[model samples]
Target: MTTIADRVRELTVAREPFVHATVVRAQEPTSARPGDAAVVLPDGSIEGFVGGVCAESSVRAAALDTLRDGATLLLRVLPDDTATFPDTPGARVVVNPCHSGGAIEIFLRPVLPAPVLGLAGGTPISVAVATLAEFLDFEVAASGDYAGATAVVVAGLGKGEQDAIRAALDAGVGFVALVASRKRGAALLDELALTDAERARVHTPAGLEIGARSPQEIALSIMAEVVRAIRVDGLASSPGPAAARPQQAVDPVCGMTVLVGPETPHARVDGRDHWFCCAGCHASFTAA
Candidate 1:
């Protein structure tokens, strides 16, 4: 049987974003135990058990939050009670009213793929950028493969530069740059038939103006700009379709919040759908 760890590895290889949830602490009367692990996909589906259905609801919500922000979170799910725990910087506390009088603490960590840099040309600057990008934890690929790249750099490729730049722009790659002199870059941009908005997206004379003279220095400046774009400007959004938050509803029987998904227990009543955190709630609402 494939374990949760094995599944995580597969997802990593596939460059899919997911949250790894592990039960680190469980109070008495809870069904979950320490070391229980699960993988939460972007669509709010779980592959393993962390706790009972009610507790799972809380885990799913917190897992999605961690995935959105790319942060590790310590999720504390407590039975609705007056007792309190010390506040931790990276921890989130949720009171599960439907829980069976117990608490579980689960750790949620988001695993995201590294940003990919599409590099063109075999010039010295191109070689330097590739080497430096790897050191900065970026996945390097050929400039032709800019379909999902966060950034593309066309380095002095004498020919076919316009093709690569046009493709990257059309694909909406966040950062597109050309390594050329100011005059030459402007001339190249003019050669391409692009709209004003599309023309403005291309960065001519790429990299920070740090008076760089050597290939390595120029590479450093370019990487610095890329980092600014990612960290400061939020230019590197997730590569694929925008992640949409799961629809949510309240369980009328228990007043517990639940994520609405295909697998969630729900009932249609009077031409409307009523969601439930567990099957018991669904049955109770239907019976009433």
Candidate 2:
């Protein structure tokens, strides 16, 4: 029998995105009770059990499904060979078991680690962008902490700004924004050996459609664009099939993934449907 502390440590240290299936409550005749724990790996492997073989099997499969969604889940195993489901992120499976003759409730919550968004800047405007991004929930870490979405916005790309952008792009940050004059942009583009497509990804004058002038305004615009990019790229699931069409294929530029169907975003590149998530991505692709 594993100690609760050991199971708890496993839950904390497991290196992949996963879910937690814990026997939160169980009937007297059930095999599980509060504190009984299990670690649901990204591959759906399970460490501990809260129920019989049949019930654990159900939990294993469900854990994988939840991992695919990058969402948390809660499950309950019922007695009488009839599964009773909870109305929340929980589910119940019914099975007649010899050991656990009663119903057991388990919580399956997904653990999605925060993505690292490295905002490489030190200017007042850059500081504002950092603050706004944090307010909006993008992980703000150092430039070297490139675990997830490493987006680098070159702050007012003046004489000293190239180092930051160079470091960020070299680190393979998916998103790069350049806040510089068009002349400066031209110079940087010429200097960097990055491919045309890679060069195109850089947002020279970063921000949304809103015309921003002040530091706060510029920050808001840049943040809006970041939010747009995040909505377009981040996450495993769409808000739904409507707000966002499911996309198994993603557009690298705008970060929209078009689902496989008639609703997919495709661009006619040399008479071929270059699949895209939006016209913006298509345009970026063509421009590149």
By lDDT, who's the top model here? 1
Would you list the C-alpha lDDT of every candidate in the order shown?
0.88, 0.62
| Stretches of candidate 1 exceeding 4 Å from the true structure | 82-84, 237-244
Give a tens-digit lDDT track for model 2, residues 1-288. Answer: 676457656655543466777887777666667777777665445677666544565566566667666666666656545444445434544343322466777777777554455666578888888888788766677554443454666775466566766666565666777776678787876787678767765777777757788888988987777667666766221111122222355455543333434644466767766665444555768888
- Error in Å for residue 105 of model 1: 1.0
Poorest 10 consecutive residues by lDDT, candidate 2: 236-245
**TM-score of each candidate structure, all chains considered together:** 0.94, 0.63
TM-score of 1: 0.94
lDDT of 1 by residue, 159-239 (tens): 789988988887778788899999999998898977898887688798999999999999999999989998998887325
Best by TM-score: 1
Clashes by residue pair, model 2: 72-110, 73-108, 74-90, 74-108, 82-94, 83-93, 83-94, 246-259, 247-258, 247-259
